[model samples]
Target: MPFDFPLIATIAAVFLLAGFVKGVIGLGLPTISVGLLSLVMAPAQAAALLIVPSVITNLQQMRPTATLLPLARRLWSMMLGVILGTLAAGGLIAGANAAGAAAALGAALVLYAAIGLIQVRFQVAPRHEAWAAPVVGGLTGMVTAATGVFVLPAVPYLQAIGLEKDALVQALGLSFLVSTLALALTLSGAGVFTWASVLTLVPALAGQVVGQWLRTRIDAVTFRRWFFAGLLALGAFLALRWLLA
Candidate 1:
């Protein structure tokens, strides 16, 4: 396939913005980039384009915070669920019926935003992590396979588990990193992921670094306001695409 410079430019721009969002917060690169890029490409292709950058950025976010062993031990069930769910649904991601998946992704985003905006915080006791992890992880994996975004149940579930702010952010990074790996493998198996797309890693990482730098100067509240608002709009756009399709 020829390297279409224009398309590459568009992708870089999208990743740049998406990376900034991640830098400002701790998530959103895959969600925002895949969601927006789908506007110009097929959902599967869009999802593939996000892989390299998402993996690197999430791993970068994950390394700096607390020890990984304990957190991973606690979250193992959920991670297992994520892998299983993703593998099972690989066909849809690799196939042509992305309309439904995109719609589902859109609905999920809107629902996630509504939940966050309403400030509904749930706390699952540590003792309950065993039973709860698999359920939430499984659901998140299923959603991720179909949509390339995995925040809904997992994020809320993490919040409910009562981790402190830094811990929560680190946990998010770890979860996303795991999801990205699972997602990438699933896509590769489905035969949609490509080496060409991996060329995007450098640009994406550059954007992520720039975003992180800028994050140091921004007000958290304002950043969040815009983030959710953007999410709401993106979700609506995706739903509209499905309705029209």
Candidate 2:
């Protein structure tokens, strides 16, 4: 199903913006893309279009073959929970439920940005990973199944673990990479992802390239301050859409 010219253009523009944000911050491809595209398409369809690009960016983050092994070892149980949880929710994640998920995603975004703006730190104690990882990963997977957004508790949990900043980022990358892969599998099983949606990847990837180039020239810390601010606005819009509906 080739999209109309206008729809194609909109998809391109959405990804261009989303990719730039991701390059600056190392996340938000799914959040930004799904949030914006939901305005014009079904949440599931919007999610479908994100499949290829999300995986590509996460792969970039989780690079150096050696980097993945330790994280994967540490994260495997949580990652397993993510995959299983998504599969379990497969039946309920469409139609009206998808809208509800969007609303929930919106609310979470608003809260997430608020937390980021305040520069507060939350920690997960080392002994708790056994219990916490599965719980957090399960919740994250359920949200991904429903909303195509998966940051929430997982990010804060990862951030708080007292890993060096680099390791934390790597953990985020790995988490997102697995989430994307799990989402792709879940969406494939649901039979909602189509060839046309996959085609959207070309433009999205192109936008990411431009975003990566721009990222090097900018101050990431300063940009992130503004980024969270913009995220607040975006979240409000999404919340309003749900309210208006």
The candidate that wins on lDDT is: 1
RMSD to the true structure for each prediction, in A, is 1.6, 1.9
> TM-scores of all models?
0.94, 0.91
* Cα distance off (Å), candidate 1, residue 236: 0.9
Identify the leading candidate in terms of TM-score: 1
Off by over 4 Å in 1: 64-66
1-245: candidate 2 lDDT, tens digit per residue? 45389988898888888887777677878888888887777778888888888887777777766766887888888888887877777634464576676676678778878988998798888899898888888888887887888787778888887877677778888888888888888888788776665666677677778778888898888888887887788778878888898
Q: On a 0 to 1 TM-score scale, where does candidate 1 land against the true structure?
A: 0.94
Model 1 clash pairs are: 122-160, 123-160
Q: Encode model 1's per-residue lDDT on 1-245: one tens digit a residue.
A: 46788988988898888887888878888878888887878778888888888878877877764567778888889889888887777667667777877787788888877776677879898888888999898888888888888896999999899887877787898889878888889888888887766777777777778878888798977888778888888888899889997
